[model samples]
Target chain A: MRKMTKIDIITRPGKLEELKEAMYAIGVTGMTVSQVFGCGLQKGHTEVYRGQEYAINLLPKIKIEIVVCEVPVEAVLEAAKKACRTGKIGDGKIFVYPIENAIRIRTGEEGDIAIMDPEDVEK
Target chain B: MRKMTKIDIITRPGKLEELKEAMYAIGVTGMTVSQVFGCGLQKGHTEVYRGQEYAINLLPKIKIEIVVCEVPVEAVLEAAKKACRTGKIGDGKIFVYPIENAIRIRTGEEGDIAIMDPEDVEK
Candidate 1:
């Protein structure tokens, strides 16, 4: 019955590795990363190919999602912000949510156990 | 203030279009799609490339995220589930979270307004 919070970090794709390393350093091993398209203050850019102009409305971004119960939410937020900081408009955004449950299909683990590394499980 | 809920659906990439159409039919337009990698009961596969064997433990997944305040959470959930249903192990998973707030960077709108379509905005 541990409480869990899910952190969604959307930022420049190039900064993913830095954020990953930072989170991992804090023992937050399990995460889901995705390539996304978003429109922020930076909006998008226009490109021409084969003499045809195309407007790309959504800019490319990366989303790192992690659900944790033991890790402090503030610590993870700081780590993500530190890694993603660029003092630019399109540095991206972070969203925090309260997760009700998590289930691991392989092992049928639930809650906090579902997101933990196998090594952390009892051998 | 309106209570907002964010739904995160992780499923096969191919099902994205179907889900989008379904949600749109229900007037759920604002969403974020991401290309992600995950491992469930499927557990990925092994491939041979140029006389080398590569084991991909994580399979490709598409995560569709939508934050809504007006749409009924159950309706959106049912639509996503119906569209993503395959009766297969990897058909996907749905994670729902409570969202505190949403902001639109372009106009500095917040809360429910941030998620509304411009067409839905007043003249």
Candidate 2:
């Protein structure tokens, strides 16, 4: 069984398209994208409501999850940083975790085969 | 020095409400929910497009991510299974990963403290 790593990238919503292109360029095609609310170190900006200031803790963010077995983890990280970085807070964070196994429900393919792109498999 | 685990649950969107209630009942409050697309072994279903048959490979799914330290991992799994399971194809999957660390952006809290519910901290 090959080792698999799941990379969870939470970044600015505006960077999705660029990020996708970067991932595709790196041969990382299998991904799950979603909208998420992130509450991080930024302290958030204050919003005034009827002469009162309230802190909005949760901010809208986009999360992209990709599990890789063939691509180098470093490559994915570099691509993400280059595409998503703005040298500012709210640029988001990345979390890496070890995946014990992954199974494809339709074909029952497991591990690396379960997540690989067909084009990669053909090559 | 608590161990933190991240559970990623991908399930039918209709079960979201039930899953949320289950998590709340178990004192698991902090979660990130997102809409995603899952492609698996199901082979997809056929759809007519312009009088032509097309295979829809991707299925819409709801992914909920939660990082837990104090709450028992098994409990979360059980609750999720109970809420999301339909004993049929496309029921989705659950993946568990080891979280090296977690941080709260606003207060700079790290590890378990960063993810615990305030109510849990008070107690």
TM-score of each: 0.55, 0.56
User: Which residue pairs show backbone clashes in model 2?
Assistant: A40-B105, A40-B106, A41-B105, A106-B41, A106-B42, A107-B41
lDDT by residue (B1-123, candidate 2, tens digit) is 788888888877888999999999998868998788654421333533235653532457888998898898878877887788765555666666787899889788888988887666669
CAPRI quality band, candidate 2: incorrect
Clash pairs (backbone) in predicted model 1:
none
Model 2, position B86: C-alpha lDDT score: 68
Candidate 1 per-residue lDDT over residues A7-57, each given as its tens digit? 989987788768877887776745777777776432365533345644653
Candidate 2 per-residue C-alpha lDDT over A1-123 given as tens digits, one digit per residue, 9 for 90 to 100: 988898999998899878877887887745777777776543656533345654754777888888888889999999999999988656789998788656543344556875665445546
User: Cα miss at A69, model 2 (Å)?
Assistant: 1.0
Model 2, CA-based lDDT: 0.75
Residue B77 displacement (Å), model 1: 13
Give each prediction's DockQ, rounded to 2 decimals: 0.17, 0.17
lDDT of prediction 1: 0.73
Candidate 2 lDDT for residue B113: 88
Lowest summed lDDT across 10 adjacent residues in model 1 chain B is found at: B40-49
Q: Chain B alone: TM-score in each candidate?
A: 0.83, 0.84
